[model samples]
Each structure stands twice: as structure tokens, then as C-alpha cells.
Target: MRPSGNAVPAARRPLAALDEPVRVEYRTVHGYRRAFLRAGSGPVLLLVHGIGDSADTWRDLIPVLARDHTVIAPDLLGHGRSDKPRADYSVAAYANAMRDLLGILDVDRVTLVGHSLGGGVAMQFAYQYPERVERLVLVSTGGVGRDVNPVLRLVSLPYMDQLMHLLRLPTTKVVGRVGAAAVRRLPLDLGYDVDDLLRIFEALPDAQSRSAVTRTLRAVVDWRGQVVTMLDRCYLARAVPTLLVWGRHDTIVPVDHAFVAHAAMPGSRLEVFEGSGHFPHHCEPARFLGVLQEFLAATQPAGHDTDAWRRLLRYGRGDGATDAGAHLADQALAQSHRTAT
Candidate 1:
């Protein structure tokens, strides 16, 4: 049900500064109009935003990242300026669409950066097309652990589809406003922050967006938590340079996931923002960009070796590991050197 007109919260406020003008482009993918943001030039950096979020999520970080890297941020289907369609919203499907979008744009080999739900999609992308990703960055990503915010779990219920429909009604805007106001007044610092949560509600005032959000979330989450996990398949990411970042106060996806995933992936780097919530990049942009730039500068791009990959599959470890893997190991050792010195 909707709240009164004056009860709704304000639109999501921009936390990051966008000084430079980024270009927005559109293309037809699978008969749907897809929108994306592009700027700067150098090593390709593909940024994927989470569910209920658009390319706008990257607005603050893009200006700086684009200075040295060609930044490409896409609005996943059913979010942002992109067309909302009743289609398969699984991670695999989103990955395939990303592949097609890149192919059409004539872009090759990219450093994939994904946030939240986008992080799951990024992992799926790397898994499906290993040769295309050079490095991987997951920020408050999903599909890494079983624990998630109960809000997401609640949405994945049996009658949630009907509930989502009710949320799309005219009354929802007022309810959203009231909820947002109530959440904003609470002291979220004691646990997880609900600022982003309120924004998600603000974005779902219409039927189309509401349906898209429900379908997208249900594909990866359920009443228990996350139904899809990348832990088992993390070994596949061994050849690709990986970095994990999370906020200590993240309520949606626990920060423990970053540590668990870092340990599982051998030499992957992990950085936890002590003062941030679910959206670290928004809460701590400087640190986020710094860590990203350093990782990109230090690590080598991954090049797939079919023989080595097959050997990895057969022997449970590839004797012919890529130079990228060796580079990462070297970086680890060098860090040890600095520590010793």
C-alpha cells in the first residue's frame, strides 16, 4: 500500500561528485534498447551495477577511473534507462548479454568491475568467457556467500510476485516515502546502513521497474539467502587477477564474504573499508579508486591458454598457468618484501 503524498522520501541523493560529462549511448540488444555510459581511454574497464541500480551508480567513480582507463558502465536490462523486458534474468543470461554488447561495440579484453548483484554477473561473465576478462574486481558482490540481508531473502518468498505487484501500485510511493523517512531517522551506524535500501524503494515506484526488480532478485536469491554461489567455481578465477573490496558495515551482503573469498582464491587481494556500508565506493570513493588503480597497475592482464585450461581441468591444477598468475604471485611476494624491509 502507498503512503500519503507527503510521506515519501526524497530521490536518492548523489554522494559522489560528477564534474566531467560522460557520454551516454544506446544500442539494441535482443530487440531491447540498452543504455550505457562511456568515457576516457586506455585499458578497458567494464563496470556493472547491482540490481535496482543503473549506470548512475558509477557516476562518482567514473570521472576519475576514466582518466586512465576506458570506463564502460552499462544499465543492466530492467534497470536505468534500459528497456525493461520480460526475459531471462539469470546471471548467465546477463553475462551473455554483456558479451554480445561488447562484441557489438568492438571492445576486447576488459578489467571487469562489478558491485553487489553486478558482482555476481561479473563472475558469471568471467566464467563463461574467461578469455575476455583480464582482471576482476568485486565490490560488495553477491554469489560469494550464503548470508545476505533478510530483506532480500524476504522478497524471494512464494507470494512475493503478488506482493511486488502491490508495491507497484500508486499507494507504494507514499509507503516508500514514509519508510524512507523512518529509515533515515534511525541510527544505522550501530549495524548496517539503510541509505541504499531506501534508494532501492525510491526507484521502484512504477510497475515496470517493480516487476524487473522482483524477477532479477528472484533469479539469484530466495527466502533462505543467496541461492547462487561462486565459491565452488572460484578456482576457475585462478588465472584471472582478482581483488575483493567490502564495507565493514554492509548489511546486505556481509563483509565476511570478502575474507572468505580472498582465502579461497589463494592470492586475491582484499580491502575492507572500516567506515563504509553496503556501497563502499559511494561511502569511500578515494580508497576504492586507489585500491583499484594500484591493482590494475600491478597486475598483468590474463590471456587464456586452452591447453593449460584443459590441463587444469584434468589435473586439478594447471601446470601451464598464465603469466598473469605468476605476476600476481610476484606481487604477493613483493608485498612480503616491503613488510620485511
Candidate 2:
């Protein structure tokens, strides 16, 4: 699909040294400027980044994936180059923004790929507009369970705004960088995630960005863990081709959540990267790309059937039971797995 007239090219930048330069563009949606990276041409692949991240998070994969498919990676509102105005930072709201952005670009259907918080937004989008999604790819996705990193939980607490303001101070920034460097030197799984985590931390130095992060975090997390979950609606994944990729060493969102989510979503494929942490795609780009390409080649793009969707929504996979029953079963299974782990 062609981008609409209002889709203005912002600036051109090379995604990587080995890759062709990709165009970063802007389109005003609802009076807010939205930034996105659009490259190559074919069937569309919409790549959504995690919280506190921009479209550039997928820079390595974008060049490779663009060779075979059009890749559209947008910086979610309140992140990266996008306008960070005070607004609804909930997953549902982010999903709506994606829908609007896609519509503006005249994209009808997409193979949706989301990471971290973006995964929750993608699932919500599929739930709200199943007809527009051809497939789903979730990477270390949140909203699968009540388990999340304590750092995020702390960020969701009150007074974090003031605390984050302090993070912007030069002395604190230097200390943070030094601490991160020190952590990376340790023999721990967390070292794999230090750079990525530090990037996210550095991005939140400003008040608006920090507030956005806090609001987004609080929407899905609390002092304990993730407050929202997709287990109840995972049965709907039966209609859509789904792939779940996780790092076996992921400390931010436990790898167990991947197993639980895989079980909850029937027919979903799960790949665990042994040496990686939260950001498997970044840590193991080659294998991640291979698995993604294989999945895309093997599965047929799902066609939306209004009647079938309605039935699935009403009868829960047509197994002679309501979705409520399926939800309970999923919860029990998830609980059992959590306990066993």
C-alpha cells in the first residue's frame, strides 16, 4: 500500500553500516506528529518496539526483512522522535494509534510483530481489529502473566517522576553509566541486558518522556507485577498464526511467561535464545531473523472470517464451552506451570 499524501518524509538515515539507508518519515495524526521508518516493498510487516524504545530497535532486522517485505516500524507516541504529549498511554490507546497510523498509510493488512510492551499493544490490536492482522509475532512480550521485572514495578510506583528527574542530573547520569559498565563486567545474565536497559534509562531523563514511561508502566504493572493479562483472550490466537520468541535468560520478563503463553495460545511456536536476556532480537539477530523468516514462509497469512471470529469470541474455539470456561482453564494451567517452575 502507498503512504498517503500527508505522510511526509522526515529525514534519511542509514539503518546500519552494511544496510541501505532507510527513510524516516512523519505524519500528523490527531495533531500529534508520529515518526516511522518505512523501507522496501512487498507484503507488509509492521514492527513495533518495546517501551522506551523507538523504531530503530529493529534496525538490524529491518534491513534484512525489507529485502523480502515492506517493513514499517513506528516510534510509539510518547517515545523516541514521536510527540510526547500528555495522553492516554494505555496499551489500548497505543493500539488505536497504530490503527490510525496504518490507515493513514493505506495499509490494509499486516504481519504484526511486537516486542515487550509493544506485544501487548499488538495483541490488543488483533483483538480489536482482527481483520487487519495477518499474523502475530511476540518477543519477550508483556501482558502474558503477572510476573515482571522489579525495576518496572518500582517505576510504576508514586514519586518516580521526581526520582526520574534526578536521573537527568549530570552526576547521576555519569554514575549510572559507570554502574552499568561495572554490571556488564560481572558474570551474570543481566550483563547481556545492560546496554539495552541503559538506553531505556537514558531515554527517560526528560520529564515528558519519564512521565510517559511511568504512565505506560502503571497501566500494565503495579508494585507487585503486571496487572493486565491476555490469557483470557489467547484462545483467539487459534485463528491467527502466532510466534513467541524469548530469551531463556530473560530477567525482565521471566522466560517462564513464554512457556505459559505458548501453552495458552494453541499452535503458537516458541523459540528460546539460551545466551540472551530481555532483547533476544538484538542479542541473537541472525537466529532471530532465521526463525522469523522460516515462520513467515511456513504459515499462510490468516484471512479474517467475520462469522468464524464471532463464533470463536462467543463459544471459545468451538469446543462446546464458553470463553469464560477456557479462561479458567488457561489460568489454572498457567498457575500450575508457574508453581512447577
Candidate 3:
């Protein structure tokens, strides 16, 4: 007859609570504008968005998690709101940017949650700074393996990377808007059922609106060289309380990578969202939020916690891509904190 705490993020809490546009004027080591979004207050949870995505991608799921987490999602340098330096744009650079941001915020520890490229950064960060990460969550991540789709192979080409730079070089105004619209449209037409991409777009600042598209594409293109050190290190992926959320129909990254990551990190839990594509958090909001909350809940410490629905935090947020979307709604929580300043 009683309820749990995490329920607020699921039912009542507005996404804006977690989507509050943070405009910190933080800079990279070399001094480039880096913006990030921070919300909620509990255990520190750092969220990393995937390729072509900013913190806005986590809009649907953050409120739910932020209800119980001090959610901090950064637009990796050259992606969302971070600086787009012309220097090295490898995954290692991106990971270092994260480390710098954490240091700025004085975040010494966290349950790192990364999606796509962000996921790669998270894994690599965990490998580099094992003590800082209390837990790890990889969602449709890259850098975990070498098996990539033919389309991705083309996207990651050196020539294509140059082309991206050339395009953004002339003018990022009309070019940026056109590219942004295309990215949103094509993905929606392919798999996502959402009609209002504007809602997500609105969450971005005007400053971001100008440079986001071209910069994001370039960042995606530039972060092509893969790193296997984290993947090779079993202790990194499997060392902490790990949670992986992936979509079964994710052609962009494919669904099998989840299993591959699980295989690499034995006992690591997987959530393959059915009928969902790359942005499971958006396509299947209810289910995605449910599973994510459950996963995080399982890792939540007890005693002082008083959320009523906390008990109902069951259900692994994952389903086999081929399997029906039946195996949802069980308590599955996963493990964060640190001072960067």
C-alpha cells in the first residue's frame, strides 16, 4: 500500500527538473568553452552521451535517475557545449576532457554512465581512473570491440572526417541548421516514433543551436580511432557494479554489441530494449526509465533511504532484441560521488 521514492521521476517529476540547461563556462586544459548540464542531488551520476548526441539525448531518462542521483551530463568537447579544439579529437582526448570537467566540479568519484561515444569515454575513464568510478553503465557504447557496421566504416573514414571539417569551415550557420535537421529527421524516419524533435532541441541553448550540428558531426567523425585497452582490461568493465542499456533494433551501433560487452565483462547485466532503436531513452521512455531506475536502485545503498517505490525498483531494463518486450519491470539498481573543484 505504500510507495517508493524513485516513483517521482517516473510519474510526477517533469523532465525539466533534470534538463535544466547548465551554462558553466568551464574550459578544457587548453581553454575552450565547455558547457554541461547538472541536476538533482543525491549520489553523483555522470552521464555521457553517444556520437551525434548531447546531454539532450538523455532528456527522457535523466529526470527519473536524477530523482535519486545528482545527474551530471556533459556535452563532450566538440559535441554538445564543449570546446571544439582543432587538436587531437580522439577518444582519449574526450576522456581527458571529462576528467578535467570532473576536476573542475571537484567530482572525485561517480557511477559513470556513457552512451555511444560517451560510453567509450566512460569505459576508458574507468580504466584510467579505476578508483574514481564506483560503478559503470555502458549504453550502446563504442570502443568495446572492433566489429562495426559497413555504414559506420564509411562514416569513420579519414576522408569523410576531412569533408566534415571542410563543410563546417565555410559557414556553420545555414550548414549547421541543415545538417542538424537532417540528423534528427533521418533517425526519426528510420526508427524513432517521436514527432517532436523540437522538444529535445529546445533544451539546447541558443549558443549550442549555432554550432551543435556541424561540431557534433565532426566530433563523431574525428573520434574514429578505437582504443582497446579498456576492453582488454577485464577489471575495468567487470570490476564495478556495471549496467548496460541497449536497444535491440539499434542499427547505428547494432544490438549485438550489448552481448559482446556482457561477454567481455562476465556477469555484467544487459537491457536490450525491444522495438527501440538507438535512442531507447526517447523511443521507449516508460520502459527505459523503469529499467534504468531499477538498475540504479539495485546499486543504491540502504538504511537512510526513504523512497517508498524504492522497493518496487525491480526489472532489468533490458530485453533480447529478438525477444518480445516482456521481460521488463523488476528491481535492478546499479551503483557514485566525487569533488572536481
Which prediction has the highest lDDT against the true structure?
Answer: 2
Reference-based TM-score of each model: 0.84, 0.89, 0.66
Runs of candidate 1 with Cα error greater than 4 angstroms are 1-20, 165-192, 317-341
lDDT of 3 by residue, 133-225 (tens): 777878777654444444445545445544544434536535655655676566443334222232333333444343444344344332432
Could you give candidate 2's per-residue lDDT for residues 1-341 as a string of tens digits?
A: 31222221122122334464578999999999999999989999999988888887886568788888999999999888899988988888998999999999999999999999989888988988889999999999988778788888988899988988988899998998899889979998888787778777766647888888788788788887887777777677677999999998898999988877777777788899997899888777778888999999999999988888888878765563345545654764454222100
Q: What is the C-alpha lDDT of each candidate?
A: 0.78, 0.82, 0.57
Q: Candidate 1 — worst ten consecutive residues by lDDT sum? A: 332-341
Listed per candidate, the RMSD to the true structure in angstroms reads: 8.1, 6.7, 11.7
Better by TM-score, candidate 3 or 1: 1
Question: Which pairs clash in model 1?
Answer: 2-171, 2-172, 3-174, 3-175, 8-177, 9-177
Off by over 4 Å in 3: 1-29, 161-189, 193-229, 300-341
lDDT of 3 at 170: 37
lDDT of 3: 0.57
- Candidate ranking under TM-score, highest first, comes to 2, 1, 3
For candidate 2, the 10 contiguous residues with the lowest summed lDDT are 2-11
Residue 304 of model 3 has an lDDT of 20
